[model samples]
Each structure stands twice: as C-alpha cells, then as structure tokens.
Target: MKNILLILIFTSMAWGETPHDGMHHTHEEHVHEKFVDGKKLEVDPERFDKFIMDLKDTQIAIVNVQGMVCDFCARGIEKIFKKDINVKKIDVDLSKGKVLIAYNVAHEIIFEDIRDKILMNGQNAIDMQVIDL
Candidate 1:
C-alpha cells in the first residue's frame, strides 16, 4: 500500500498536477522572478513613435498592468489578447508594465474585457488609455 501511494504521488507530480493547499496545481500558481533585477526598462521615444506610426489606422489601447515582472508574464498577456478577434496587434512591454493593443478601428474599446483578460494572466490592469490613429 505504501509503495502504491508513493507511485501515485510521483505520477501526479510528473504530470504537473500535484495537489497544493487542497487544490490542483495550475500554471498560474507558479511563481516568477522579476526581470533585470526589477529595474524598469527605459523607453526610447523614437521607437515608441515608430510603433504608433506603424499602427496608423488602428485604435490603440495602452493598458497599465501590475505584476507583469517577467517574460512569462508578458507572454501570458500576449496569449490572452491574441484570442480576441478585434485585436490587430499586441505588444507587452515588461519594462513599462504596459500592454499595447492595436484593435480594429471598427471595434470599440472594452475596458472591462481587457481587465478580465489581464486578470486571467495573473496581472492587474490598473489603468487604460485609448488613442485613435
């Protein structure tokens, strides 16, 4: 019985489904370290201007996110936003703690939906700005 129990526990861990605090472990529960020792990346004004220029016809949403400290966090945000059909382009800047989303001009910006998606990625969308270009 003891060997059987040990085998079951090892198998569950190998499958990435180990129990934690009475709940099944999930990717979101994994901890991530800060990028660059938590130093904010300096934004180059010229590059930012180019990014805006490239999405001339789209409506851009600048979402200020919290807890976006690493590349993993950025990728999670990118994955969530890419699922939205209205999103034309998505960029996650961990240095600025922002998610820049270029949406189709015909689609209206939905703050609530954006907030929800960020939450799903284990981040908080604290503020948002919209610009039509």
Candidate 2:
C-alpha cells in the first residue's frame, strides 16, 4: 500500500497534478486558475439557458454590467450576490458582460437590493431583467 501510494504521488507530480494547498486540483480548475477570464463556474451558455429554463419556484436575474474587466471583477460580483441568502447559483460571463443569478422562490430578494449588491462591488449594473422559468 505504501509503495503504491508513493508511486501515485510521483506520477501525479510528474503530470503536473500536484495537490494545491492540500486539495486535489482538477484539470478544469487548473485551466480556470491559469486563465484569468475563466474563473466562473458555469456550463456552456446554451446548456445554462436550458438548465434555467425548467427550474420551478426560482428567481433568475440576468444583469448587464460594466467595469467587469478581469477575473477579480467577476469573482467580486459573485461574492456580493452570495450575500443574499436565497441566491443559489451565480454565473458571471465576462465575455457577455453579464452576471446571471438564481435565487429560491420562497425568499425572493428585491430587485433594488440585487442591483445594490452589484453596485456595491464597484460594478456598473446597466440593467437587469427577471427571467421566468
């Protein structure tokens, strides 16, 4: 068992799959970390839209934002949105200049508060629309 473990460790290191801060990093995670604009945890746009299309008793808001030029901006927006207890999923698409937020129906947050959350992140939220699903 010890020899197998040692061999696996060496193989992982040789393959650039070393543990990061004691956590195993997946290939996708490594790609995201190395590429500044790929930090968002989202499926492809088409798949995302379809996934949101059938959700019941949920609030989906798509916000057009300005000043989201980097990964930090995207992550900052995510952190701010997560403050709302009901926000279940967050997807930031810097390429589209949009932030997609989904919250539970039982605790829908006011639009003004959602806008405030975006604005508080030093981002200019141009507009937001609630998508019915």
Candidate 3:
C-alpha cells in the first residue's frame, strides 16, 4: 500500500499534477480571479431564465453589457439593480456578457434609468431592448 501511494505521488509530480507542480496554483492566488475561490458554481440556463421570469408583471429589458469578467461582476450589477424598489429581477448572461432586468410596473421605471444603473456598476450597457410580454 505504501509503495503504491509513493508511486502515485511520484507520477503526479512527474506529470505536474501535484500541488507543488507548475500549474497547481490555487485559484485564490490568481491576480485576476473574478470569482471567489470555490464559488464558481454554474446553474442551468433554463432554470436561471425560469427563475428570472417568475417575477411580478412589470417591465423586462435585456441589456447587453460589455466586459463582464465573471459571476462576481454580475453579482455587483445585481446589487446595484436591487437598490431600486422597482427592480424585480436581474439575470446575467456572462457567456454573452449581458444582463436581463425585470422591473415592477408600480414604479414606472424606464429603459434609460436601467441603462444608467447598469453603467453605474462599472459595466458598459451597449443596448437595451424591452422583452415583449
């Protein structure tokens, strides 16, 4: 058993798969780590969309945001959107670098205001299109 363990260790080191190997750096050590370590979980796109659409009837707008690095950046945008009482949901598509904002009608919020809010979070909102209900 001991020999087997030693052999496995030697092989891992030889192949640069061990913790001390060249590419074994912890994610936290990365300079541009966009997500918190161990928090890079992914959700199914269908489920995420369904969750967002469940919001109360209001205005839904899809905004294309450029240069979103990761979920952390998306969460930052979400936080900003949440500050508005009219906001119902904020869905981010990091793959395409966009955010879908759903607002409650009670507040009569407009697209320009949503765009400004997104930009205020340090993301560039390239375009906004209302989702046809």
Candidate 4:
C-alpha cells in the first residue's frame, strides 16, 4: 500500500497535478502566444505569463530601475511586485532596466510604495509613472 501510494503521488506530480487541485501547482511554467509587429511571437518564458493573462482592467505603472543585471534580479522584481494585492502582473525588462506593473486602481497603490519596494530589494529606482490600460 505504501509503495502504491508513493507511485500515485509521483505520477500526479509528473502530470502537473497535485493531490490538492487548482491552487499551488496552478502556476506551473507555461508559454504564451502573442502577436507583435504583424507576426506571432512566443512570449518570453521568463515572464509571469499566467498572471498577465488574468488581467482584466488594469493600469500600467512603469518604473525605471537599475542594478538588475541578471535573471535573478528580474525574478526578484517579479516576485516582489506580485506580492502586492493590487498588482495583478509584472514584466521585468532587464535590458531596459524597467519593471512594468499591472495594478488595479481600487487599491490606490502609489509610486512611492513601488520605489520603497525597489530600495528594499537593493535596486535603484530612477523614476515611476502610470498609464491606464
């Protein structure tokens, strides 16, 4: 019975399903289909594609940043912003040193909050502005 249970658990995990359904494991890695410049493009795998797809009506808050030189830095930014209840999604453009945040206006998040978050994460915040999407 023990061996059979172990096998079942492993099999479910292998198939990207956990014993607990539709919660923790739902954020498993997945690609996105996007059309850009009159051509179809596979979205960046490094991005938080699942969260972005769930955006309904959001505002884009662009934060000019610095000191993000690697994948880990981008991931840190992604994780930090995603923690905010108001932040629906985040895209960290490492090359441009910018973090694009999709936030719901109901929470009344401000640029200062984002700037402080960046400072806490050891990244420099250069500028921040918002645009309705």
Candidate 5:
C-alpha cells in the first residue's frame, strides 16, 4: 500500500498540468505574428512629413542636453527621448554633446520627465527653455 501510494503521488506530480506552459506557447505565437504581419502597414511619406512639421510647430519648450561625449552617448540619449510620447523632435550634435528637444503642446509637457530619462541613461540635462516661436 505504501509503495502504491508513492507511485501514485510521483505519477501525479509528473503528469500535473502546468499553468505556464499554455501561457508561454501563446506568447510565442503572438511574437511570431508581430514579426510576420507587423511590417505590412504602409505609411504615407507626405503625411509622415507633415506629422513631423506639425510637431515642430506645436513645440512649447526645448531642453538643451549636455555631457554627451560621443556618437554612442548621443544615440543612447536619442533612444531615451524617443520613448517619450510628448517629445516631438530631437536634434542631437555628438561633437557638441548638445540636444534640442521639441515638445508638443497637445500633450502634457514635463521637462522633469525628460531630464530624469536622460540622466538615468547616463547623461546630463543642461537647460530648459520656452520655444522662441
């Protein structure tokens, strides 16, 4: 009876349904679909250009960044700014280690968030300014 009970317990443990198995399988399928059909969406070049122009026109403030030592450093800073939904346009000069950030008025502008993001990415946020326009 003892041996039979042990066998049953071991069998149950071996055959137990794992909740994570199905989740991982579904996640892989979702990733595959994203990689396959994600590139099919077409973007109009004129519309895209206009979208950028519109963003530039709506910028309320600019943040001048510093401590960007090299191209890799500037690229890192650019990548962080790209994550911000409020940032419209980013102009970075690797040689000068400066960044000009243009923000959209339609979105809630938070210079602190931008500053924090750049600093967190191992750079400096030098100055903040209202757009001249």
Candidate 6:
C-alpha cells in the first residue's frame, strides 16, 4: 500500500500538479505599458523625474527593458553594470521596466555595451535614451 501511494504521488507531481501549486501562484494584475514612437515602452514619469534629480552633473542612460519582472532581474542588471569602471551608479525599476545608469561627465555613452550587459541578465534592451545633465 505504501509503494502504491508513493507511485500515485510521483505520478501527480510528474503531471505538474502539486499540493501547493495554486497557493504559491501569483499574478500581477497591473500591466505597465507605454507607447513611444510606435514602440511599446514602460516608464513611470514620477520615478523617472526622481531618478534624474538624484544625479547631478552626470550623464544618464534610461534603458527600456523587457522581462524585468522581479527583484532578481533588477539585481542582475545592476550587478553587470557595476563591474564597468565608467558606470558611476545603476538603478533598476521593475515597475517601470527601466534601468537607469549614471556616468561621469566625461564618460561616453555606449548603447551596445549597455545592451550587452542587460542581455547577460536574460533581458532585452528595446530602446534607450541618453540624457546629458
């Protein structure tokens, strides 16, 4: 009887039905979407304003990213950029689906390099805006 019970449990698990399946499942109801130049983009204006204000006399890169749904995604992007000597600081906003990078005044803005770092974190860089402030 114990062997038979174990077999049934394993079968259920193999079929992708677990006891806690529904309990742990979560869905984010709020969809963050914006259209810029006929492309779907996600950004929070207030957050962007705040982020820009925090960096003084620095060049900022606002990268529109896809698949940044969790904190791990955010941290991964941050980690990759932090290794670059030109990057002064980095911030990832999952809600806005944007990665904000600050560079010193003399630092050059390289979109391909930024895209590569984001790609390393399993995300896509859809668009980028470089602001000289």
Better structure of 3 and 6 per lDDT = 6
1 versus 4: better lDDT goes to: 1
lDDT of 1: 0.66
Candidate 2 residue-wise lDDT, 1-133, digit = tens: 9999999998886532111111111122231123233334223457456647657777666666777789875787888778767887888877777777777866654556766777687766665555434
Q: Predictions ranked by lDDT, top down?
A: 6, 1, 2, 4, 3, 5
lDDT for each of the candidates?
0.66, 0.61, 0.58, 0.59, 0.51, 0.68
- Model 4 lDDT at residue 23: 10
Instruction: Write the residue-wise lDDT of candidate 6 on 1-133 in tens digits.
Output: 9999999998886542111111111112221243233333345767767776667777767787777899964787888899988888888887777788888879877677777778788877866766566
Q: Give one digit per residue, the lDDT tens place, for model 1 in 3-117.
A: 9999999888753212111111111111122223342223444544656666756776767777789996578788888999999888777778877788888897877788888
TM for every model, in the order presented, reads 0.64, 0.58, 0.56, 0.56, 0.50, 0.63
Q: How well is each residue in 52-79 modelled by candidate 3, as lDDT tens digits?
A: 5566555556566666777876687888
Candidate 6, position 80, lDDT: 86
The alpha-carbon deviation from the true structure for residue 52 of candidate 5, after best TM-score superposition, in angstroms, is: 8.4
Residue 105 of model 2: what lDDT?
Answer: 65
Which residue pairs come into collision in candidate 6? none
Point to the candidate with the largest lDDT.
6
Q: Number of clashes in model 6?
A: 0
Candidate 3 stretches greater than 4 Å from native: 1-49, 106-109
- Residue 89 displacement in candidate 3 (angstroms): 1.4
Residue ranges of candidate 5 with Cα displaced over 4 Å: 1-56
